[model samples]
Target: MRIIKAAVLVAAGAMLSWTPARADTVPEFRGNDTGGIIAYELAHRVDARQLAVDHCASYGKVAKFLAVDAQYGGYVSFACRWVPYGASNQPLRTLY
Candidate 1:
């Protein structure tokens, strides 16, 4: 019985984590940025820090990824063409 209860709880927790959470408020950034958001969402599933550092300019060039189209869920997100949120609010605007 205990094992079954634990499994049920675990399954519920997993489902909750997978459930998508929309933002309650949107930012004022009006740009057609989609690369970062797309990459972030995809990158999030797997641990690809090294790939992000080498491929993602925002990760290395900028410092933070300004999420223009961010999706909320069990975690926070950032997806922008050029906005700094990491590395103490610094960005690599020159790349974009």
Candidate 2:
């Protein structure tokens, strides 16, 4: 009975120490200027969008989402379009 208890304790400790591998949550960008593709999980779409916006902003442009592909995971394709001057520069109002 004592040996069985020891085995159970060891198994519990081992189980507690084990950790599952984590998925890559960081967004990855590819391409330049005119357009680009972003690779990321659906769970992290907001981060991916922000990345795209930042990338386009460097080119003095805005990110225009083109498509979302779920094949082989997820991807967001976007274009860097120029934002016209005198356009509404107000902070985005969210209904949330």
TM-score of each: 0.25, 0.53
Stretches > 4 Å off in candidate 2: 1-27, 42-46, 88-96
Q: What is the lDDT of residue 29 in candidate 2?
A: 67
Instruction: Estimate every model's Cα lDDT from 0 to 1.
Output: 0.43, 0.74
Q: How does model 1 fare in lDDT?
A: 0.43
Q: Model 1: runs farther than 4 Å from truth?
A: 25-96
Give a tens-digit lDDT track for model 2, residues 23-96. 66554668698978877564265576677777787777888899988776677899988887799762232231
Judged by TM-score, which candidate is best? 2
> How much is 20 displaced in model 2, in angstroms?
28
lDDT of 1 by residue, 1-96 (tens): 999999999999999999777666443222233322233354566543333333345343432344333453322234334444554754432321
List the pairs of residues colliding in candidate 1: 62-92, 66-79, 66-80, 67-78, 67-79, 67-80, 68-79
